[model samples]
Target: MLRTLFSLVISAAVLAGAYVYTFGVPGSVAAYFGPQQAADSSAGAAPSGRGGGGQFGGRGGGRSTTVVLSPIEIQPYQDVLRAIGTATALRSTNVMAEVSGEVTAVNLEANQMVAAGDILIELEARNEALNLEIAEAELAYARETVARYEQLQTNGNSTVTGVALSEARLALSLAEAKAGLARVSLDNRTIRAPIAGRLGLSSMDVGDSLANGSLIVTIDNAEALIVEFELPERAIGILQPQQVVRAMTPTFVGRVFEGRVTSFDSRVDPVTRSVTVRARIENPDGLLWSGMTFSVELSQASAPLAMVASTAITWSQSGASIWIDNDGAALAVPVTILYRQDESVWLEVDLPEGTLVVTEGAQKLRDGAPITSADAPRGRNSAGDAAAPNARRDTAPRAGAPT
Candidate 1:
């Protein structure tokens, strides 16, 4: 009986092997060949195969889970504004020759600092002095002739015409003397500085002849430096005279100079829509020179805020922006900034209380780009946010909490 049972068992095993070989895989031919089938099997299993499939996939030990992805949830982030600014001297001037003369000597050298009324250059005046002496002699002779004519008239010995002629002669001599005096002054050809400033390189040398109104050399008031910049006409609302400003300059690296808005242009630039603005900075050491180029940054009005975003997202032209996730999609939104702190920006775009914004990858998406929810940051937008749809907006992640 035992022998018979063994033989029967061996026959059954051989039959089963032959059946498997002929059919390849019994009820799992599709499972071996199809990826969907493999994934379905994994999804159906619990995270660690501990239990049956659940609504949420478990962690480490839990089996795989099936998730239906929707759209990415991004948090709002601060925006940093950037601009390029130019620099200028606090005081500047285009000095010109005040009198006509040949440049005899240049007292102040180019690029040297000088005081007010400092003798800058001189001209030859020997001829003028001689002419003044001759005028003095002529004037004395005229007065003596007038006295002699008066004596003759009083005695009734001189004719009326004779007396008149004598008077005319005296007047003519007096006028000649006055002309000589003026000519004498024309030779006082020492050029004096009009204002205290740094002298620029002179275009004239010792022998260079200069006419009145000729350009002598430029002088700039480097006692302090002034910077002029252009602002948008729209800024008419916020700027005030003497408003303080701070900037970084090439000459003063990492150092901030205190400045004030001194003035602004009356009209706006039609093309650039910018109006001129002037800021003056103190320079007692005379370190800041004229014609120096510097970069600057300014704000019309500023304050403190909770968050900010990219200006590019603002979309319309200026102001703030928001990414409205309407109908489970990402959309850009614009807002006005409340204030700017440090390099980060701040805005208040009255959102509907609790709504997620698409802060990053703004260029990658349109108004309604599909997003997925995986693990996202709270209160900040960035790439690689959650994409698979799982949580509801009403139950969105809180600030400083993991998404």
Candidate 2:
């Protein structure tokens, strides 16, 4: 019986804790439906308000409407940060064999840098040399036959059929000679770099027997590097090209590799809902390599704009809004948000001069409430140092005071 009672008590305690987390605490109240402040304003010493539903409009001499002005500054509407990227080699190729034979020469080694057309292999060519010499002799004989055919035809001393036969024999000899030359050329089996790049570990040893198209080594163009990374699909439309980005590898911690966005995938993957982006960067000093893993951070802010507002001053509902002193009442001033950063919303609105926006008593009052600024807190309610144009609104007492 005691165990059962203890279990009940523990369960009740847990339920109470969850209630506090979901609803509100008894003394200190908070709600997510509203309450925002401009981030750019200097830190406010105190900003406290009650938690409740609906637009709060206060009607009392307890608080007076004051035109609190947010200090003007530029803030960027960032594209919710993106994946990191790094500089990498742009082009890389694996050297392969076109012919086969015993290795007679090895011009490059593992880790050696090579240029285009640089020979890196050789196959023994004793048979090929003999074939080339035979081709030259055949070519000479073919030329002599052609000359004789022409001479006979000019002298009109040979039948037309005889001259034609000689011509056919010459053609055959020429064709044979060309075939021989091709065979000889293929015998050398020299492999050269197709591009200027760094050579990587070769699977070939000095005596490695390679067939045609067999990979000899890998070459990577290190003059420039490109990296690809994935980001959330929602981030695709807002991302901009040439945005500065940085990356780092575990092996090279604390030293960032700089890069920029070169392109982004046109569409998001259906299964993953992520977009892939490519970045190109200079890989000077041959530091970046292919297939190396890296962590990257891509900046999403398009550009800083003048007249951005502190995000905290804005409240959210089905859309977003702000508060201001309207006529004799605390007005729920709806605003268009340029961006939302943490607790602040970078926003913009067109308003006449001397418009008083409520930075305090927002949760306790509504749009038509008669407000008394006497109990309003000192300083701007954005948890900032935004000074109101009127001294009365700026110096009002804080929240939790007698109305």
lDDT per residue, candidate 1, 218-261, as tens digits?
Answer: 77877677787766665677667987777667876888777777
- Expressed as tens digits, the lDDT of each residue in 207-311 for candidate 2 is 767787777888888777788888887776667888777777777779888777789888889998899888776777877777777787765665654333353
RMSD, each candidate, Å? 13.9, 12.9
Over 4 Å off, model 1: 1-91, 98-101, 140-184, 207-213, 300-403
Q: What is the C-alpha lDDT of each candidate?
A: 0.57, 0.61
Candidate that scores best on lDDT:
2
User: How big is the positional error of residue 325 in model 2, measured in Å on the Cα after superposition?
Assistant: 5.7
The weakest ten consecutive residues by lDDT in model 1 span 59-68
Each prediction's TM-score versus the true structure? 0.52, 0.64
